[model samples]
Structures are given as structure tokens and as C-alpha cells.
Target chain A: MTTTPAADTAVTAAALALGDDALVLSHRLGEWAGHAPVLEEEVALANIALDLLGQARVLLSMAGDEDELAFLREERAFRNLQLVEQPNGDFAHTIARQLYFSVYQHLLHDRLASGDGPFAPLAGKAVKEAAYHRDHAEQWTLRLGDGTDESHARMQAAVDALWRYTGEMFQPVEGIDGVDWPGLESTWRDIVEDVLGRATLTLPEGPRTGAWRAGAGRQGLHTEPFGRMLAEMQHLHRSHPGATW
Target chain B: MVTTTPLEEQLLELAGSVPDPELPVLTLRELGVVRAVRAHGTDSVEVDLTPTYTGCPAVEVMSLDIERVLREHGVREVTVRRVLAPAWSTDDITDEGRRKLREFGIAPPRTGAASGPVRVALGPTRTREGGPADEPEPVRCPHCGSPETELLSRFSSTACKALRRCLACREPFDHFKEL
Candidate 1:
């Protein structure tokens, strides 16, 4: 198609926002490499991480150099959702994060895939992979939420703790054309509520709206844990600049 | 439409003949990743390769292998461009590729399933066929050809396959999951 400088800048901003989300979450999931509770779970998490990493590479490349965008960017420059940068506290917490983010991502990509835009091609491909990731989270949520007193308690607590971060996901991102943000948000709530109901867990009563919502990653603002995570992530690349296998 | 020259056709064949880095049993042609090959003046060529999964690590190796193979076949330069529009699907795998996958102890993905967003069905894996519009035929075990197979894990050793075990033979095998 045709584009002006303003449209190109908007596309770049949107690409960086989406790309940073994938890159940050991929690294967080990759941290579970040797620490997963089981072998199968470890493989599954890594596989999902790889998928996100692949998406990150494509999206970041659309904005600028993928490696530089990922490794050299300061903490205040990242545009990822704060929810994705949250540490993997426990198995239950990680699954909760996956459930919220994948549902939003899958739905968003599904909409983007149906559009004629810069992100449509990658969205068309990633939507399928996101379906699997969403399924994985949903299955785990059901098992843990309905399993036993302790598992159910942990799952409930995890979802509630992360509830505040849910609101930021529905915020409209620039250059992502042709999406019904409010409709998507309502649908997200319905899906999450159904899953939680089936899992025998109560929906978090935390405020997900209003001015106090936990977000601002899109504006290069992040939570306390993000700086440490970025330091650890960029160390290797910075130490050995221009290194290759 | 531009008709491919004989040299382009031959170069396409050479590029497509490269074996997949992950599944050596299938060539890139059989896998349906090598979309097309174009020749620019006899010495320079470009090949189109689509990834099975967005993050499939094999794509890099496949590109390198294709370049090496085409270059050795008398082309001075080779360029492999990754195409993502009309995203690659399991349905793209050739019938021969499916048969070879089954022969190699991996159940092939069911064809004819509509490509798009799929609902998450969480529960015990059943062996029912024609159950619903979304659910296609049951994945039969490649070893014993038993239909009583259950999904163990959605993500297996690779992104494109799922780990499943046959209830009859108690053998676990990877099934190329539908994208």
C-alpha cells in the first residue's frame, strides 16, 4: 500500500509496543528452563517462549534492529505491558498471567488477521500459535483451580493479585486499526469469567478500571521489577558486543 | 503470469530437494515450505520459503541448506526470502509428506479443517470421529494404527507436533498438530 511519514511513525510505535511485550514475556518464560516442576511442563513453556521470541523478532525487525531493540533499550524505553514483565512467582501465577495475556493477544491477533494492515501477515500466522498457548493456560487453570483446596486457593490468589493489571490490556493502541476495544474487553471478561467459574475460582474483586489501573508500559513506564529484569537480560549481549555463534 | 524458465524450474527442483532440518524424512518440497524459485540472469537466484511455525528454529537451517544446495548446483548467488502472508498450515503438507510422517512414527495432522481461530476444548482426549465441526478425525497411533490415542501434551519436542500416547499399545508418539 501507500504510506506517509506520519503513518510510518505510527506503525513503528505500534510495532515496538507489541514487539516488546513478546520479547519481555519470552524472556520471563525462558527463566523456567531448569526450574519447572515437571519435564513436560518445562518443554511446553519453552515451546511457547520460542513462539513468542519468533514473533518478537518479526515485530521488532519491523521497527528497527531486533537485537538492538531488545538488548540496548533502556528500561524507560520499553513499551511492553507491565503485566508481561511481572516475574513468574509460582506455577499458578505464571499460568494466570498466560491466561490473561494470551486471551487478549489471541483475540487481538484474530482481529488483526482479518484486516488489511501492516501487522496482518504476522498476526495471521501468530494467531494459530496463540490459540495453542491460550489452550495450555486454560487447561492448567482448570486443573489447578478445581483440583484441591490448596491448588484452588493458590490459583485464586494468583488471579486476584494480577487483576489490577488486566485493565491496561484493553487500552487502545495507536496504529492498530479496525478493532473494537470495548467489545474486545467485554469479551475478554466473559471468557475469563467462564473459565474461572468452571475452575471453581471466584473472579477477582479488584478494581480493573478507573484511574488506578495498573499499566503505563505503552508509554515507556514500567514497574519496579522491570529494571532488574532488563539488566539481567541485556548483560550478556552488552558484554560481548557483536558476538555470534 | 510469468512463465518460469527451464533454468528457474531446475533451480526450484534443486532448492526443493533439500531435506528438512528437523524431519529429515521429508524434503522441503514435501513440507511445502519452498514456495518458488526465480532466476535473475543465470547466476543469481531467489527462493521463497515459508515457515511451518513462526518461530520454528529449522527455518534458518533450511535457508542455509537451500542456499548451499543451489549454489553447489552452479548458481553463483542464492537468496531465500521468508514469506508470511497466507500463513503456512498443516494442510500445506503434501499427502506424500503425511504418509512419510506416519511411517516415521508421527501421526499427521488431519486435513480439511478450516483454518482460523479454534476454540479451546479442555478435557480428556476422546477417540470419536465426526464429533463436531471443529473436531476432525481422531489421531490414530502411527505405531499400531490404533484410534484410541490420547493427547499427553499440546507442545511436544517441537512446536508443530503434540505428544500423544496410544491406549492400546501404550506407546507415545508425536502428532503433527494442525496450525
Candidate 2:
């Protein structure tokens, strides 16, 4: 059961990518802690955020010190998905981001969990939690998509706004296997389409590939919003280093 | 590694009885998180535990509680180790623990089903002996004996339970999610 050095390095990098995604999104969701439109949603979002945070802890710890990786890393050094670091524009926008990401996450975890990959244990444990996360997002998508004209429009626009970020998720990450990206992408689209249809919203007619694809979070080139978000996230930790709570 | 002592064994019993922070009705022993309590020499104690869920925040509190309880009992030093190798599952919850959950207004984890995807229902009493039934037997209401129930949410106040509403009692209760 020896892993080649190249393979080991690849798995570590992939883990870093996935870890960053969870860490960033967890922070974004945590921002909605008190400001959620409803009380139940606040708890729900927090629960999801905590779940992702737990995952980030495990994943980042695999690469290096979890605290250092999460708090000390520079903005250009982060490898999180751009979609996750995107602002929680509104409740509708947050849900839209959640729907796309959770679906991808669930499928990715499922694939990993079903195999003998380096991440099998974590994936096996996380897949169930991710299932609930996906369900939570799906249920909300259905509710908000079908709730009212105003709600529907907002949700639809959110889906449209975040569509570009979806392309980067399926990019072939080295040292990772067992994930069928095309199949995963199709499944993601199918599920999103079903939810959008049930909500009576149309898919945004935009390019998700070629010249219009939005990505490079894997390469540590994030969108403009990420720098400010990273500063805010690391502020308290950076402010009081070596001070035990 | 130190051998067990009489007083250290007593401390194990007390530590095992420490109630889970979230599910107060169940003890750490009943929940099966207390894997071992070894005596690290005469004055020190070490207790091993596993979390119900990998990311459950309560695990830290549970560790601190174990230490606090043991120290309060005049044990000089306490160490709580979190082990993650074999991993924890719902099946780890003992029969006493399951019964306690039900008695505490929470539905217990239903047995006689595969660990795969399940269709949670409040319908009829279907079982493995019932032969090739695709669906699980309904989660009976913890408040009332009614099988008429609805899954309100896949999550509840915590990760281990789903929010359920009983049509008979019109009360929303937690159903320990089968992990």
C-alpha cells in the first residue's frame, strides 16, 4: 500500500483545494449568523457552516497546521473555489450558491467515499453530512424558487450570477481519481434543472465553458472580493496570536 | 501505559456516567463514546472517547466535562483522548441509550435496516423479516404511539436527529437520524 511521491503530492494539493473551498464557504455562511431572514434559517446555515468548518479542520490539518493554513495564509495563497468566497449577497443569493456547491460537494464526497482513496475515511464520514447539507439547500431552493414572484426572480438571478463559477468545480484536479467529472457535472446540472423547473425559473443562457468560464481559484487566483474576506477572517486570529481563549 | 487501580476503576464509572452535553438523557457509556479509561500511574487518569459525528462541536465539551467531573472527584490529573481510527457509528449507541433517547422524546435509531439510503416513514411496521420491503417501518411518534408522522427536516437541533412532526399529537419531536 505504498503511494508514489507524485501521487502523494497530488492528493495533498487536491485536499488543499477542497479544504480551502470548505473553509471559505463556512466563513461566508457564518457571516449570516445573526442576519438570516428567519431564525430557523440562521440555525440551519450555522449548522451547515460548522459542518464545513469541521471538514476544513480535518482537510487542512492533513496539509499542515489547520489554524495556520486557515488564518495565516495570504490572499493569493488561498486555493478555495471562487464561488464559496463570493459574498452572501442576499438570502436568495446565498441559497443559490449553496445549491450549486452542495450538489457538487455531495457527489464528490460520494465518489471518494465509495473508493479506497486517501480521503476515503473523511469522505465516508462527511458524505452523510453533505447529504443533509444538499437536502437542506435543495429544500430551500424549492421553497424560494416557488414561493413568490419577487423571491423567484431573486433566486433565478442568483443562479444566473453564480453560473460561471460552476465550471471550475469540474476541472481535472491532479492525483484525484474515482470522480467522473462529466458525469458529476451532468448530474449537477440535472439536479439544478429539476429544482429550477419546479420553481418555474428558466436557466440563464450563458457560457459555462470556453472564453466565458470563470475559475482559477484552484491556482490561487481568486476574484477581487476574496482579499477583503480573507483579511476579515484572519483579523482576530492574527490580532491575538498565541493567546489561548 | 499504566495498570488499572481500584480508585482509577471507580473514576471510570463516574466518567462513563457523565451525560452527553447535547443529549443529556444519555451517558457517555450508554452512547458508547467512552472507549477506555486507563490509569496513567497512581495520580493521573486517561479516558478515551469517540465522537458520534466527526464535526460535532459537542465532542470538545464532552472531553472538558469528563476532565472536570474526574478532577472534581479529587482525581489529581485527567486526560481525555479522542480516538478516530475505527470511527463511530449510530450502532455504537447501546440498547439502553436507544431506549433512553426514545424516553426523552426522541425516536431511537431503527434497527433491521441496511446502512445505505433509507426511506424514512411513519407508515407500517415493516422489517427485514417482513421480506424484501424497500421502505423502512415508520418512526413511531415519541409523544404518542401513532405511526402517523412527517419528516419536517433532515436536521434538528443537532446533526444526529431529524425534525419530525406527529400528526396525532401535533408535536414536533426529534428522531435520531440513522447514520
The best candidate in terms of TM-score: 1
**Candidate 1: residue A12 lDDT (0-100):** 97
Q: Clash pairs of candidate 2?
A: B121-B138
Clashing residue pairs, backbone N/CA/C < 3 A, model 1? none
- The RMSD (Cα, Å) of candidate 1 is 1.7
Q: What's the count of clashing pairs in each model shown?
A: 0, 1
> Where in model 1 is the C-alpha error above 4 Å?
A209-215, B114-117, B122-124, B128-135
lDDT of 1 by residue, B1-179 (tens): 97899988988889989999899999999999988889999899999999988899999999999999987888998999999988988889999999999999999988855354554553346565456665657889999998888988888999888899998899999989877
lDDT of 2 at B4: 69
Put down candidate 2 lDDT per residue, A1-245, tens digits, no spaces: 78788887888888899899999999999999889887667878887888898888888988889999998999878888888989999888999999889888888888887888778878877776787787778777878889888888898889999887888888877668878888988988888898788878787667664353445888888888999998899999899996577
TM-score of 2: 0.84
All DockQ scores: 0.79, 0.31
User: Residue by residue across B1-179, what tens digits does model 2's lDDT show?
Assistant: 66667876787789989999998999998888888788866678888887777779999999999999988988789889876544566777889998899899998877644266522222232222343466566787888767777777666698677777887888988888776
TM-score of each prediction: 0.97, 0.84
